[model samples]
Target: MRAMYTCSSLYMCGTRDSIRVAMSKLCTFLRHFGVVACIIQFCILLPFLCRTLPFSTYYGVTSGRINFQQRAKMLNEDRVKHANLYFKNMMASESYRHYHSIGNGTHMYLAVAVVTVRRSGVKRVNESMGYVLQTAAGIDSFARSRNFINRTFVFICNVDSQPHKHEEARFLEPYLPFTKRYGSSSFSVKDIQLPHSDLTYDEKMHKNTREKETFDYSYCLKVAESFHPEYVLMVEDDAVPHTDLSSVLEYSLDNHLVDKSKGTPVKKKFAFLKLYYPEKWQGFAFELPRVLELISIGCVGGGVSLLFGLMVRSSKTKLTHWTMCQYFVIGVIIFMLTAELVCRQNILELRRLSKYLYQFRQAPGCCTPAMLYPRAIVEPLTTYLTSLPSPQHTDLAIYDFVIQTQTPAYQLEPNLFHHIGMHSSLGTGDKDAEHFVSTFKIK
Candidate 1:
């Protein structure tokens, strides 16, 4: 029995030794190749990590798909909240009553013309109200808060030829000065005649719509001119003004429009100052300047990482493999590249830290939601627009005219207006309306 017990103990000890040997071998193998395996795994999972990680926690700027989803959800909630508030205020009739009672027909420093038509058969969170009421409420709220009612003139240019059909415009008439285009003596469909003699049925319909749109815009400009304000702001009825609209406009006028030395206006610097541009276009696109900037950043990051790796390798004699240093530098470069790609939206949010620090760039072509035009350009722009032989979209027509005339047009960064319209008044539904709403940054 004693001999059997000793043999069993020896067998157990041998088994333990064999297990230890196997573990040692495994550790040596990992020491030799673990870095490469780790790098491969990290590269494979980088995109997924970026999408899921909450970058806002570190950067104080919202980023990542998860963060964006949260932000979009919050925006929808805020929209619902604002809609309810605006509805209540409009219903009370006390908010805008004083502004309405103030007489129009006096010259003002600024004239804001809201060009709108009746939009029907559209779905909205607030069924009783559309974008116009919310927009009007926003404008009224801004004007009253800023005490701009006396110095600034606000009016609605209902371009819906049939005034009775536009009940919202009619409802707003008592609260703000409203003008209808149907019976205006100064505007006529004949005056905006375009060459559509050879066009097909569909083409003619489109052409007519485009011509009418241009006519409506031109008429609004003319109406604004009649007020004889130094600056005329044309706002689409569906474009809701941001809370910073008043301050930004004032800043723009003071800084960009006026000559500081003489304290006189130099309106020729720009044809018009755009208050809003599409949020999608504002991202870091692969333009030449942006590419150059990115490359420079990469070079700087690579240099710093290379230096860091060299310093560590020199200090630690154990890290003798040159490949270790190379891997370290490469890993850092990859990290920087990943951060740049993943945190693009967060990087953009950095620009919004200060509302007044926005830079002006050349105006980009597309929609015209909110534009502040100089009084000097009003008559000339109207004449140039009317002279176009072919019917074109108002925005395209204006862009063409700017290019042809060599007019220096500028657009503000961090848009001061939010485009809230789901339906286009130009006879088309916005297919990307949901995308716009989701991506729009309130800051």
Candidate 2:
């Protein structure tokens, strides 16, 4: 019996040892399979990781052995912080008030962004600057009235002459009031120097004019973006707003005064607030009222006009596209010249052609009805302030006090609506000009 019991115990011990060995082999195989499964999973995820993640992030992750998902979270957090900081800082800028005033107000805003250019002759550059200053002063005085209380004004002066830059600054400083001064008073005189390159001789003579126009247009666009005002008053350095400028603009803006009464639309091409002519000219001599309804203002010297969608800006690049650029103007001219070509041969619509014709018709002397009469008379008054001998000086002051109003509902005429600018003739020794200038001088 003792021998049998001992045999059973040894048999049970052997069975236990066999079971332990089997379990150990199974565990080793499972461990190897688990590693293989992990490798397969990583391989499956590799292409997805490459496709979903940016190359820079991917490189930083694998090469640096950084956790990819963790890094992505950190990056997102950093961007949020930057955006918040930018918003906070922007809220504290002068642009903020300028923007809000434009957005929340009912009145119009006029921004005369000026860039002084060197002329070809000894013509006083300061004369144009003086005109602009007086115009600004006039506008400021008008704003003090109830009619223009909601209006805002600005003049972005870009000095074209590099060496004489200080002179330009001095010319402008006296006109602007201390309270309404441009830029930070804390900035030193040295900081006032424009950080731009000098213009070449050819550029100064020709391209500089276009640049001035474009720069002004661009500045208007930028200021418009911040304010989204009801109207924009684009003026030139030589323009002086008439004393009744605010009243004129108000009349134009008030639809009841201008358009509402003429439900069928006023039979005029270009709209005008006031067109001043030299007072010396006999009204009947020019076959026009001393100042005919500025109905035929030409888009010259970039003044006395208000147009919308005529100017635009790109937020992405902060770059601007001006309608007055050579390329753009050339394209517009071509479109006008070839409207009949496409009208007959191409699949273009008549409406498109009509729009172009409308703009052209509005321009002075472009598409006028054939007549034996002289359309405009040259006015010469100033023998003027120039080295040039004699009364060779001419002052073509078209549409002064012209205010172009733009609202979404406003519609333009087609055939004779193309000329959307101020046009007035300037001549040396014209008695009419002399009287006009003398009568219009501010006391």
Candidate 3:
């Protein structure tokens, strides 16, 4: 009996040991399985995360600052700390940072994003910048009448990153209003420079200017998203906004004045509000006003035909009305050529009524000389702009994104802004772009 009891106790101990071993094996397998799954996920998703991520958490981004050596010589670790804190407080900067509010609830409503570079023999930027400020003041005045308050801030994006260029452009400091004032100021600067060993936009450059411009423009656009303005006024340095800018924007945005009354398909289509064009002007000149030119052509042409008909009796049949009309047209063409020259009066452009009155569903966005975009689209626009593969020029890239998103865009008639520079910044006097020819050049 004693031997049997001892055998049973040993058997129970062996069973208990076997159960413990099985449980431990199961725990080990789960641990290893979880680790392997996590590793796979990390490998699969890292590339995508590198491409797109919400980076607004960092408030004070001084990444693209030029004159890095100067920054190091004149600055200390405090600037680094500012950048660190910017990232530290990134997620909360949903809307405004320091520029939005001043005191007593005063706020800024408009932001003009201008991308500029150095241009030799260029005075158009000066006039253009002045007009932009005047437009800001105009907005202020209009807002005051309605008992609403607002401010318009300008963001000048300089694409040159070389320290020497900074020295050359030092004279531009007054109009830019930065480099001293920090801590949530209305203005800021960035250098979208590339590592071009010694390639200027002039010589057979190492890098593609089109690619560089797109990136630089993209960088400025991303910067604008951080400001959180009500509407983004995208303008080029060498361009001017119209005098009635405030009235036009106010009328367009508040009332949907473009296609609101037309009851057309454009009312439901995506759109852009363009403010500048070369042939477009303010006041009476809105319509190309070629009425006198057309009349002169016809009369001069008709008289010449009649004199020739009297001199040489070539046709025996009586003249029909159609024959006389053809003769009149021929005379008109002759008069047009002899009168001035085919410089500004493009027959095709003359026919479009858009030259006379504000048009809805603006022409395809070819240039960003002077345009407006709502703040709501900035975030998505940034994402879309950055995500494109091997984009073309910045203007077309942005327009494509706008179209893809189905947004309404409008263009001012008689062009609220005018091209102000004749020379290009990509290279001295380069005319690779058609718009760059007489002042619409973008750096």
lDDT of each: 0.65, 0.31, 0.47
Candidate 2, residues 1-443, lDDT tens digits: the string is 99999999999999978867875665464435434533543444443443332222222344445444444334334433443343334333454354245435665454333322323223333332233334444444454456765465444343343424434334444333211112332111222111143532213232334333333232323333333443444343334444445553454445322354546754222222222222112111233531131212222212321122133222222223543353344333333322212221121113234322311212221111100101111101000111122221111112120121220112112211111111111112112211121113321
**Model 2, position 133: C-alpha lDDT score:** 37
Put down candidate 3 lDDT per residue, 207-311, tens digits, no spaces. Answer: 476766665565565565455666677666556444445555666665553355655523233335676644522212224344554565558767886555444
- TM-score for all predictions? 0.68, 0.33, 0.46
lDDT score of model 3?
0.47
Quick one: ranking by TM-score, best first?
A: 1, 3, 2
Cα RMSD for candidates in order? 10.6, 32.2, 35.7
Steric overlap count per candidate: 0, 20, 14
Encode model 1's per-residue lDDT on 12-58: one tens digit a residue. 99987886787567546535443654465345655444443333223
Q: Please report the TM-score between candidate 1 and the true structure.
A: 0.68
Residue 161 lDDT, candidate 3, scale 0-100: 44
Give me the candidate number with maximum lDDT: 1
Off by over 4 Å in 1: 1-81, 90-107, 120-129, 147-149, 183-207, 261-268, 296-340, 343-346, 439-443
Ten residues in sequence with the least summed lDDT for candidate 2: 373-382
In Å, residue 254's CA in model 2 sits off its true spot by 0.6
- Best candidate (score: TM-score): 1
